[model samples]
Target: MKLDLIEPNAHYDMAHGKPAVLEYDNDGSWLYRLNIEPEMGIPEGQQEETQIGWKCYEVRGYNKATKENVKKVVIRSVIDETAEFDLVNSYNKHVLGIAVNESAVEEYKEYLQFTEDLDAVLIEDLSN
Candidate 1:
């Protein structure tokens, strides 16, 4: 999956340079984080690392269970052509219940909004 690092909400501002945030509702859900790095490789006869060709996008999420942080999803690539389609399909499949007219708390509404916004951006990026 090609994952893009995005500031989905004002809370992201508090993350400083690190793109990290508790999944919008802040109900001790998953903490989403992004890491961008140059794909590096050592050239023959060279002792230094060099950028191979592409920038790697790593999307990671962690959940706090008890007192330990449990790793959740860790997507390694976010630039694949099919990423957007796959994401939308998966989201629809998994969150269809919530996406419908379901009663939810205010915090859950905020979380839905965040997901919607993120989806919009991903769709936009795909179109471009």
Candidate 2:
């Protein structure tokens, strides 16, 4: 499955030109960080050295009229996919800089497992 990066909250901002972030929420956001050298392709199922990024924030569900709400989830960073690093496109791609979410952080075990699973599927595709 091709992954897509999801931008976080409105209050956040991207700075440093390196993709690092500054969070303003009282409850921290989960971050998922990845640094991809577009010019250099990554192996499937292997964790690459993509610049670290974070995903934080709770997706909540609330009653429409009353506005009563509850925190549904606290997700650390979402996946980052600004460029493709496949073999065919490898030569054309450039390893620019890295990216970070100014909004959130990742849940440790959850992020680890998520990345592992993502790597497995992506690797299989890359091999073919």
Candidate 3:
């Protein structure tokens, strides 16, 4: 029920004022890619837009000691009293910007299906 999310190795594109970046390991290994977004909440007055903000989000990465990627959305580490389900908030870019453990991707997919209002989820291939 409760899963832990991994943070990325590093970030970039922080020059002026851009969305915070979550970098990944580039050692030519298999890494799970996930395209995620918030369930819904475009605000009542704002016109529908395509981009997402970077204020709230999380990425799952390995801790080095284990050298394993975290493929599932962390079920814990959430304490929002008003949220419908436990979640890892992240920008729902039109891209697969988040990475998880290769094995946990499926588990994350299954878990996401049960949750409503979330943005469309996409799983990326490691070979790519």
Candidate 4:
């Protein structure tokens, strides 16, 4: 699986909350997960306009699978799109907490990037 980010947004919010807005592109569409405070802030505006930081991915070969894509196929098969999003939302709040200061924006972005890079690494390993 050559995992390219289709779209990603993770943040610490006080109101409508979630830690990460994770979207995976599959079946020619995108499935999203909002991992933040359940009651944090609303997701408003475009990716660049809002305080939210977004990540976009480009999947290499979803329809056409190869030995390299096996891990991605397995992971996606195991992960239930909707359920994982809910779980992440709850877990992120429990573990990371809500936004306290303006620094949260940068912090959340960095955190999300780290996790995302981990995901990329996993995909690369499987692809190789």
Q: How many steric overlaps are in each model, in order?
A: 3, 35, 12, 23
* Residue 75 local lDDT, model 1: 20
Q: 3 or 4: which has the higher TM-score?
A: 4
* Span of 10 residues, lowest total lDDT, candidate 1: 66-75
Q: Write the per-residue lDDT of candidate 3 for residues 1-128, one digit (tens) a residue.
A: 22224333322222423332233557532233233222333645787753332223454555431212333332222333334232332222212556434445444455565332122222222323
Pick by lDDT: which candidate is best?
Answer: 4
Q: TM-scores of all models?
A: 0.25, 0.21, 0.24, 0.25
The clash number for model 2 is 35
Candidate 4 lDDT over residue span 13-104, tens digit each? 44544323333354654332322223323366544434333332223344434433533543454345664465456555655665234444
Please estimate how well model 1 matches the true structure, expressed as its whole-model Cα lDDT.
Answer: 0.39
Q: Whole-model lDDT, candidate 4? A: 0.41
Candidate 4 accuracy as TM-score: 0.25
Give candidate 2 misplaced runs (Cα > 4 Å): 1-106
TM-score of 3: 0.24
Instruction: Return whichever of 1 and 4 wins on lDDT.
Output: 4
What are the lDDT figures for the candidates, one per model?
0.39, 0.31, 0.34, 0.41
Ranking of all candidate structures by their lDDT, best first = 4, 1, 3, 2
lDDT of 1 by residue, 1-128 (tens): 12344322222221243333323335545544333334468867999987543332334343442111322133222223365454455456546663543323343444446456555544443233
